[model samples]
Target chain A: EAGVAQSPRYKIIEKRQSVAFWCNPISGHATLYWYQQILGQGPKLLIQFQNNGVVDDSQLPKDRFSAERLKGVDSTLKIQPAKLEDSAVYLCASSPRRQSFFEQYFGPGTRLTVT
Target chain B: SQQGEEDPQALSIQEGENATMNCSYKTSINNLQWYRQNSGRGLVHLILIRSNEREKHSGRLRVTLDTSKKSSSLLITASRAADTASYFCATDAAYGGATNKLIFGTGTLLAVQP
Candidate 1:
């Protein structure tokens, strides 16, 4: 089976610039998640979507970070006026709905660097 | 803001040795999962242990969950240089529907010298 897919393996942007990252979940997976992984830290959940509807996004910095998973298959995360602190790897993952035991398939991630 | 906490922030071991990492979570969880991330890459699921299951195994990976203690452990037997990566434990909070919004730990950086 094909794994999750992400675009632009690396990105470098100046501070205060805008950037967007894209993700396509695994085939038939109903749950998708976006996580931010800063250097030397674990991934932190930024948002989650279940079939086109958001399930959770409490950690998302609404002022700067936004994500959308329209149609439930693909997702895009955008950071506006990016800050130097925003430099990190953004990972996308997917899993079968209602299966907490199901393992999540992750994408290669988009590593962003804010100069 | 993190749910799980992994101990021994870093671990270095000779190839062929066993490496064990522990994780402690704050809230109750329906399941716990372990994942590995290579530098500059994404995470790969290693194993998942349900709250009811005490242990699970896959290849050289063994994961144990002790819900009573809100803790879990991952043991990798016969580690190799290829296993060098950051290992993280994630928990699915027991509340709400199963969205699989895993809250991850700080992670344990493992370096296996061959």
Candidate 2:
């Protein structure tokens, strides 16, 4: 009965570097989501997956940000050539499948710092 | 941007006082939810109100959703210093069916003085 788990609670890298984050959703959850939050702002949706198939990713920066939910269980978010603006907290969330109203459980998040 | 926008942006009150925060959204939604985040970390789900419900309560928390006005309000009665954190309002504008997306607002920072 573990909550959503994320690795590398904190990360610091220089601009133009690359970083990856891993997430493990609660067991039996079928929906996964990744969000990016800037300082003093709310979290913004970067990508969503339903059973390993992407449901949305319109807000994702395709040039550098990429995420994949493998086998509908775990997910990984990667940012290559990270830019200064990409410095923010990345959050992962999950929910039960096909729920009429989403009640998502969130992870602590990975805080990325770009120098 | 169907995200709900929380008003005031920040609030500070002493322990045992009541705290009220308002949220407004531009689009129609099926439900509204509130979340609490501490220290810019994980967000904890607080409450969820369906469009049909006008008001709901949980312990010291009270939530009112006004679909007619596309707005909502959260009130914490006799709040404690431990309640200090950032509160956010999220809306799911799934009009036709299931969009499975929650649009979050900018959030309100609440600081409770002991």
Candidate 3:
């Protein structure tokens, strides 16, 4: 079986530039999540989606960050006018929604470097 | 801010020796999970222990959870070079509902020398 997939494995952009990362979850998984892992720290969740609707996005920087899971299969996270602190790895993960508790399968992640 | 802190920020052990890491969280949780991440990669699930459970074993891994103290530990027996990676403990957001929101703790970096 194929694992979660992410694109643009690495990205580098200057401050104030815009950057976006894409993810496609494993087949039949209904729960999707986006997390940011800053250097020297564990991943911090940015948002979560169940199907095409968002379940939680309280941690996302609303002013400059936005994500969408169009068609409930693929998702995209964007950081516009990015800041230096935004440099980190963007990881996407998914789990089956059939159960109340399930393990998440993660993508390789997209490393963003905002210089 | 991170919800939990992993003890022994880093460890270096011989390949045949056992390695252990501990995690402490602040809130009540339905379950606790352990994940592993290689350098510059995403996390992979390792094991999960529910609040009622005390211990769980998987392959060479042993996990213990103490809800009264709100702490968990992961132990890797007969560690190998392949066990070298950062390990993290995560808990549900505990937002008053059954959600998959996970709050991760600072990870423990383990280096096993072959």
Residue-wise C-alpha lDDT for candidate 3, range A1-115, written one tens digit per residue: 9999999999999999999899999999999999999999999999999999998898999999999999999999999989999999999999998234578899999999999
Give the interface RMSD of each candidate. Answer: 1.6, 1.9, 2.0
Model 3: colliding residue pairs: none
Q: List the residue pairs that clash in candidate 1.
A: none
Model 3 scores what on Cα lDDT? 0.92
Q: Comparing 1 and 2 by DockQ, which wins?
A: 1
Tell me the fnat of candidate 3: 0.55
Residues B1-114 of candidate 1 have per-residue lDDT tens digits of 889999989999999999999999999888899999886555888888888999899999998888889999999999999999999999999887655678899999999999
Predicted complexes: DockQ each:
0.73, 0.63, 0.62
Off by over 4 Å in 1: none
Clash count for candidate 2 is 0
CA lDDT of B80 in candidate 2? 99
Candidate No. with top DockQ: 1
Q: Work out the TM-score per prediction.
A: 0.95, 0.96, 0.97
Candidate 2 structure quality by residue, lDDT tens digits, B55-108: 999999999999989999999999999899999999888665766688899999
Could you tell me which 10 consecutive residues in candidate 2 chain B have the lowest summed lDDT?
Answer: B92-101
lDDT per residue for candidate 3 within B1-114, as digits (tens), equals: 798899989999999999999999999887889999996555899998878899999999999999989999999999999999999999874556768778899999999999
Among all candidates shown, the one with the greatest TM-score: 3
lDDT score of residue B73 within candidate 2: 99
lDDT score, candidate 2, position B99: 68
Residue by residue across A17-52, what tens digits does model 1's lDDT show?
A: 999999999999999999899988889989988899
